[model samples]
Target: MNKKPDYLAHAVLLLGMLLFIFPIWVTFAGATQSAGAINRGDISLLPNLSHLGIFVRAFSFGSGLTGSAPVWHMLLVSFGMAMTIAVGKIVISALSAFAIAFFRFPFRMAAFWLIFITLMLPIVVRIIPTYSVMSDLHLINTFPGLTLPLIASATATLLFRQIYLAVPDELVEAAKLDGAGPMRFFWDVLLPVSRANVAALFVIEFVYGWNQYLWPLLITTKGNMDTVVFGIVQMITGDQLIPWNLVMATTILALLPPVIVVVAMQRWFVAGLTEVDK
Candidate 1:
């Protein structure tokens, strides 16, 4: 006989979905309402359509830092930095994973474990040393300083390594037989076969870079180099009393890029994680 589906599980999942979505719904509702309405917290169920001016004011408000701190410029800088980190991380970590996964060499296992050990240490533990190195290199308050320390993560390398391990040995052997060196094999075989994983990593890393506020705020003292998160923070904490409606609107805008990437590339992202599991 066909078994009945789990009604309890379905109910739990439906409840969880509503719980998670409720805050986002509230934020959207608040975005449409006045700051006064949000403060009252009474209009939680429906958006106050009477005050659509909040979004307009948020989008149109010029950055009080300087006339140049436009919303578009903040978006561009944030996207650019995130792209750089994503690309650099994927390339470097993929190469490292390829070398460790396929090669036979002295201390290869040791080196691999060393990379894995880095995963245990939080970035907070390394910040002082990393900052010292960046300062000595005169990269402080610069793009390189912002990115180089965080461009490659051990977790990314580990993820790629697991994905590479799923590739058939015969293909790598065939490449070797053809006298294709490591770089050539990686470029031609591993990368193409693992493109889904790469895409997944890029999306994940891009979101990480985009949401990174503490590190950038700590490193970048200059106003022009500030990222979108930094800009948003400045908006909230600046001399002007933070317009709550505007703050929520800007927060929503800042959130869209990563949300779009995840929604658009969700299939590949899931495929990559599943591949790693195999």
Candidate 2:
């Protein structure tokens, strides 16, 4: 006989999903309403479909609250930075982990431990010195400056190292017997095996870079280089009246890219997190 469904678990999951989604629904509803209505506490559960053009307006013209740059530009900057940081972190971490896992080098464990130690000291702790270094390198007010400092990921390195270590020694011996060199083996075998983990890490790191506010704030001095998060903050904190509708619309737009990434990579991301073996 077939087992019955777990009603309690289903109910709990539905509740949790609604709890998470309700705020987004409210935001979207508010976004489609008038600023006057939202400011006057006339928020509604149902969105006004006629006002859907607000999203287009917000993306094209911005809120005009603080003479901020256009939303499209801000979005482009954020997207580029997020992509660069994610890919950079993955490549560097994968290489470093591969070296530490497969090759016996001088002070190898010491190097791995050093990378791991940096995880405890997050960006906030080293912001000052990091800024100084970036300034010294003459990378201020640039995209490279915005993304470079955030690229190194000790956590990714550690995860990749563990994955590499889990590879069977017999496989390594077989590769050796096949005359596969280091780079050859890494390209042919290790990378394919680590694909899921890479996808999961990319999602995580992309969100991390996309949501970055403080570092971008410090590094970028030009309005043209401002990220979407920074522009959103600027829209809120200005001396002029806050356009709640426009702000809400912009917020909704800002949420799209990362959501698309997560949804698009959902399968690989889930597999990466849950799968035990390559």
Candidate 3:
């Protein structure tokens, strides 16, 4: 017998999608309108194509009156920070998980538990101490200071540990019998098998870094080092009249990188989260 269509499910999904897309559409439309109109709460649902050049202007000079760094520069800083944090977390977490899962060592489980216990400690609890340490190292206002501290993630380590644990013992035995050393096995066997999980984590960690406000706010004292999220806030909180059009345009631009990453890695992300055969 043929299966019936799930109309109710489709309708609910469509409603949810519309709910998400509505605000984004409004923002895009507002970006194409005049600042005064948006300020007067006169945003239109449809964008004015004639005003499309506003994006270029926004990208080149975001709220120029505030002496803010250009949108492009802020975006570049965020992208670099996000990439560094994501890759650093993956590499460090993977090695840590590998050691914990496969190797015999002193206090290995204890070490893993200690790392895992950090998950219970909110980042706020560590900020003052972390800042003091960064200050002592003379790393404040530096790019490394902005990213290095955020790289060690208990969640990523836990996820990686789970993935490593799921690897069949037969595979490890076969690799050993084939004379594959630890590093060789990690590079040749483990890395390839873990590709999907890596992609998923990259997406998560990249977005997390991109949207960071509090830590970047503390670490980056200079305007030039500001992330896009920080720049948006600066634009809004300036002393002069708010430029709603520019703000909306910058918001749209800030959203693109994460969207592109998710779209590009959609297949791998889904596989990593849902695949059972692995």
Candidate 4:
């Protein structure tokens, strides 16, 4: 028989859930509160529904709080850059993972190890060098510069590799017997089998791209190309005082895309992780 749920484990999980959720709750409440209330640190458990105008003002970029560029344009630029990175990363990482996991080649293990070692290296350590390279390539302040370096993540490659490894060897052999070439086998057999994993990877990659701040900040110095995060920083740092209500509202808006993706692709996400175990 299966063991009963442990009371301590349940309690710990409940505590963790609250810890994670409390900040979201606070942010929502803060978005609804008046500027005075936020600045005064007036804590409220529930949203101040009477102050719903704050969200509307924030969404419309009509909030007099920040005289900087419009929030809508910043949002669009950020989304564009994020989508570019996400799509590029998914395509490149998936193909590379498929090749490394399925094919035999010279220095295969060494190559895999070299890529995987990036997982252990801190991103900050490479920022200066990456920036210098981008400058040399005349990519500074360009969208491509912001998106290119992160086109491959060690984590995504590792996840896809594990998923590929779970594929049945017979499927590969059958494809070979049917006169399917390596690329065809990869496209037809392996890819179809790993659809859930691919969807999961796309969602994960999208979130990483969307939330990327430091690199985008470094690469995009122009106001026109500024990402939402960098734009928010600019909003706060400008001559006008920080409007916590508007800030919280914009933050919630920024979070919506990733949240929607996770909610929509939840089944694939869970399945992707579960399949790796088998």
Candidate 2 per-residue C-alpha lDDT over 1-278 given as tens digits, one digit per residue, 9 for 90 to 100: 99999999999999999999999999999999988998899999999999999999898755365456899999999999999999999999999999999999899999999999998896788999999999999999988999998899999999999999989999999999999999999999999999999999999999999999999889987888899999999888877888998889989999999999999999999999985354
Error of 4 at 54 (Å): 1.9
Which candidate comes out best when scored by TM-score?
A: 3
Question: What is the TM-score (0 to 1) of candidate 1?
Answer: 0.89
lDDT agreement with native, every candidate: 0.82, 0.92, 0.91, 0.81
* Residue pairs in candidate 3 whose N, alpha carbon or C atoms collide under 3 angstroms: none
The TM-score of predicted model 2 comes to 0.95
Model 1 residue 249 lDDT score: 74
Residue 222 alpha-carbon offset, candidate 2, angstroms: 0.8
lDDT by residue (1-278, candidate 4, tens digit) is 99998999999999999999999889988999877788899968799899877776776562343244567776787778778877787788778888899889999989899989999999999999999999999999887898889887878788778878877888888888999998898888877888877777777778888888899878876766766777777666766667888988887787787798889999998887777666
Number of clashes recorded per candidate: 0, 0, 0, 0
**Lowest lDDT 10-residue stretch of candidate 3:** 60-69
As for lDDT, the candidate ahead, 2 or 3, is 2
Q: Could you tell me how far off, in angstroms, the CA of residue 68 lies in candidate 3 after the best superposition? A: 2.9
Instruction: For each candidate, give its TM-score against the true structure.
Output: 0.89, 0.95, 0.96, 0.88
Measured on C-alpha atoms, candidate 4 has an lDDT of 0.81
Estimate the lDDT of model 1. 0.82
